[model samples]
Target chain A: MKKLINKPEDFVRESLAGMAVAHRDLIKVNYEPTFVYRADAPLQGKVAIISGGGSGHEPMHSGFVGQGMLDAACPGEVFTSPTPDQMLAAAQQVDGGAGILYIIKNYSGDLMNFEMAVELAHLEGIRAVNILVDDDVAVKDSLYTQGRRGVGTTVLAEKICGAAADQGYDLHQLADLCRRVNQNGRSMGMALSSCTVPAKGTPTFALANDEIELGIGIHGEPGRNRISLKSGDEITELLAQTIINDTEYRRTVREWSEVKEKWVDLELLNKPLQKGDRLLAFVNSMGGTPIAELYLVYRKLAEICELEGLQIVRNLIGPYITSLDMQGCSITLLKLDDEMLRLWDAPVKTPSLRWGV
Target chain B: MKKLINKPEDFVRESLAGMAVAHRDLIKVNYEPTFVYRADAPLQGKVAIISGGGSGHEPMHSGFVGQGMLDAACPGEVFTSPTPDQMLAAAQQVDGGAGILYIIKNYSGDLMNFEMAVELAHLEGIRAVNILVDDDVAVKDSLYTQGRRGVGTTVLAEKICGAAADQGYDLHQLADLCRRVNQNGRSMGMALSSCTVPAKGTPTFALANDEIELGIGIHGEPGRNRISLKSGDEITELLAQTIINDTEYRRTVREWSEVKEKWVDLELLNKPLQKGDRLLAFVNSMGGTPIAELYLVYRKLAEICELEGLQIVRNLIGPYITSLDMQGCSITLLKLDDEMLRLWDAPVKTPSLRWGV
Candidate 1:
């Protein structure tokens, strides 16, 4: 395990500390119950957006904290979920008078902890709600998720919702916009190699020299199947086709109804992508893969998108969300509407993502 | 070696093809001679800035091509410097009415080829000059360089010089500004593991599980020493201290003399960094190192800078310059004056580096 780190246990805090200092102009870090918040947080009358997850997937939840993205991000230990207290503290720190919204990935740990956080926030008289993201079409049930593990779409959802929030959307409007983005997005990932967790001092999993794990999850979770290695074009087509051909996905999620003022379980379904839909295509490196290779994947992916009659109006290619130092990539395709496209193009200033001021 | 590539030979072209498509709004990829130029090239009166090197160091030359950075970038095969023709073609394609400046790294092939390209460009009736970067303090001479090799400082120079050109700095002025930046900067790198080039299916160099190569070159060239792997802080201190304590370096480099209408060798010297100097500290990943790990390194780097009485005015941490998928990082510190700081803060809209706009 040749990682540039100190003690494994200190990895998360130290990295966060470094981030806080480096981006001190943009973000502020709070330790103990570790969470990162926008340096100029708590914009009055603006809904605060918060998200949390495991530590290994960097620049995801924490690096996204800043203007036009996330208000705060709670980080757990490596590949471990943050406790509800951390989320609660983040919400408290960043919540403006408008309200709070938690963008929770649909993993068991994240779901449960964020739900608890919502309840705790409500108990403290804060109007808080939850919007779940489960855009990974590669699995129905995985090691850490019940329906689908939230993958690449979480990044899209954050960007779109962050823009909406910046544009003065209320809590309910932000929730609906986030839900719409999640429903319209699909992702599939494949692993060229497994990532080593610093504490473990070994790779989470292994593959032969000439093999790959298709449809893999972010935390090295087993995907649909392991297969022999193939060309870049072949692998890209496989992942893209799986996402494009997915019929529909239905899942029951808990949501906070302001009218009812209580948590309610609602069954939601995502319609399959159709021809002529415009997309915001994202090709993300899984840590160890180079940006040059992501461009290769993007080349083939753009070809596939064209052949499938999907117009890729916007695209993002790089290591926005990564799994430690794993060598792989994930593709996220989000069907875009006029409003979504406008928000996606809006200004965002985060540590990991920035454009248009 | 598990990489997301098709044919080994097609790796560079395909990746560029992907980059061209993914960032078509920002850049255009030309084939055969193989150079990436800004979509809005020939800025009419602004001096065009061109750079090139091996293909593996992505987002260096090509990805930096956009509105406020590089005007064009020529890429060679993996770990190989570009030819004179590629550079000449790029100069012809992007040369504005003002002139052209080629930001060449201090590698033998790059220096030789770019020198030849300048002659060819002059023969074609286009005014062109060169600015050489040799900021790497790792070794006096290495596998591919005659003096200090250009490492992380190349990125800083391109950005600063690109902004200077955007603000209408003429050819000679841009050359002097670039020389000032290169002279004021220093860098050192370390590698945790080796990266595999596509054609060369084996690792560039091997490192024991419990060892690390300090002062490593971008192309996995042998460094000053290999020792037992240490904690991230210790390693960061080693790299930072080496750069901080480097003595004045003297080298003779070739530069075009517009007045003399010839290329001439000039001996240059760079003084060591002093206390109370303002710096733009850049911590870059060598492809595979995670951004999280870089923050850990940054934490220690920041501490060392304070102890040495240097003030960091700005910072950039990510994989801006890479060596394929090698797990390592490099640190670059550029002393900034009022003009350089202003230009450094200017809007830059590239595929990899974007800020202020």
Candidate 2:
């Protein structure tokens, strides 16, 4: 693949420098023996939010750092987590008297690095809270594996929590809200083609042009299954069904517990939803899916939602989170209550995701 | 070429429905009859900004509407501009007492459609100002044809203009600023591979894996020239040099006129740039370029900028505006003055683009 880079190892550092240069007022890069954050940050009282992962997700962690989303984002090497020290610097730079919230995606490396950063922050007398986002429904949970992988849900969590923090929600409230959003949201992705990592200089995995891997991860991780290319409607149905099955299963288990209690006050939990209960559906491109294709997925999703008697109150259909250039997409559904809906309606401004207040 | 769509025609309607359902609080779809704006627009006296174009550029126009960016966005059929009627309705719906600014990309179809909408708005007694974004430097200006086609520059235009509007810049100033940003900025694009428009379900053009087309339009239009794929550094050098050359050429011509009149204000023409004159550089993914590869491009760009004595104040490197899934990127540089930098520093809240308050 033809690329416009110098030494592959210098890509991230040089790119961050250029980003600092281009957005000097909004961002500054700390280039020394290690990458750290500059001193100037946004509102001081507001609890700072920090998130990072592999550098390949450009707008994910970095693009989101600004007034309303993240206070700082530490990007590691391409598709690799930042070192613990980097996260510690990010935490120190953004941490105010209030505190800092670490929004860690459920990748093993990211989790470990962020966890270590939290420890470092504690050592520095900074109060740091960790919120792990594990919203992907593609993976099965077992004692043996690392639970479901966090995918598109991280964006939603960051935006929602960012708004909460902006609204002066306490650190506990912000952490709780982040956890709730992650719990309520579910995502599943598919890949039509393998994305070539820059260093690898080739496709991460080989797939015939006609074949697709369902439930793929952002790092080109193998999905649960492989299948022939399906129609847009079929693809939506396949993904929606998987998500619905997972979510419904969880709901059913929760409801069964309520039923066993036989408490009359459980009416709110047991009350059947009316036609207008809100839902936020995100039809996200996994890098290579076109807007046209994404909208097609939205169309099928609408049909499925209508048939299933689910009221989709809010829908975002685009490439919010991506998987390099994997050529497929994921569907994320966030069931919303009145409060969550209001938060979703609140205005936000960030580099990549924006809406409401 | 298996797709998830039922039929090509149903894509837009279905997607709109899904969007309304997913983001009910933020957006609504007047499906079947027309593409109308949601009644829940946030600002009251703010002049509504409406923009749209072909649907393949997923988040370009529609994904931008909310909070600080756009009031309404009309989505056209794949790779085709929306009709005047759709834009007119969007204009009317977003018009909050104040006039409306139509941020139109400089495509023949988009320009014509938006122009018709402006006339329609005038007929309806609605004040409408049109700002044409013609920042692409690839297309040579000639009396025989329309000027350069708008490419990635539209994103920055919408953003800066959006911030201006959000901060209560009058409609005239907003429109003027939009034009100023467009005038000050230039973008040139290249594509390593032609993207597959979902409706077409085939690559727009075929090229060997090692080949690239320079000056490619966002909608899979033929580029100014094609070239063999080279190293990332070479590609960055080619693109950055083109942009720098254009800027320098314009500077020289202006200087020549000043010298001839003996009214040469070198300070005004060649403003003494400080060590930290803010510059915003965007290494935009045409569509399919991976974030890793995009960063590689940014790295080389930083090196070149340092060599050229340009202080990049800020940088955005990602797929902000895209060309479906074309595997390439474009670079945009906006030299920022003190006032411009302050405006850039001002906080903004939008759906797709966000920065300082």
Name the top DockQ candidate. 1
Model 1: docking quality category: high
State the lDDT at B10 in candidate 1: 97
CA lDDT for candidate 2 = 0.71
User: Per-residue lDDT for A285 in model 2?
Assistant: 81
**C-alpha TM-scores of all predictions:** 0.99, 0.77
How good is model 1 by TM-score?
A: 0.99
Give lDDT tens digits, candidate 2, residues B132-197. 777777776533456577777787777677667777887777866876677677788888888776
Candidate 2 residue lDDT tens string, A272-335: 2335546788888876666656776887788887777777777676666776667888998877
Fnat of candidate 2 is 0.54
Off by over 4 Å in 1: A141-145, B141-145
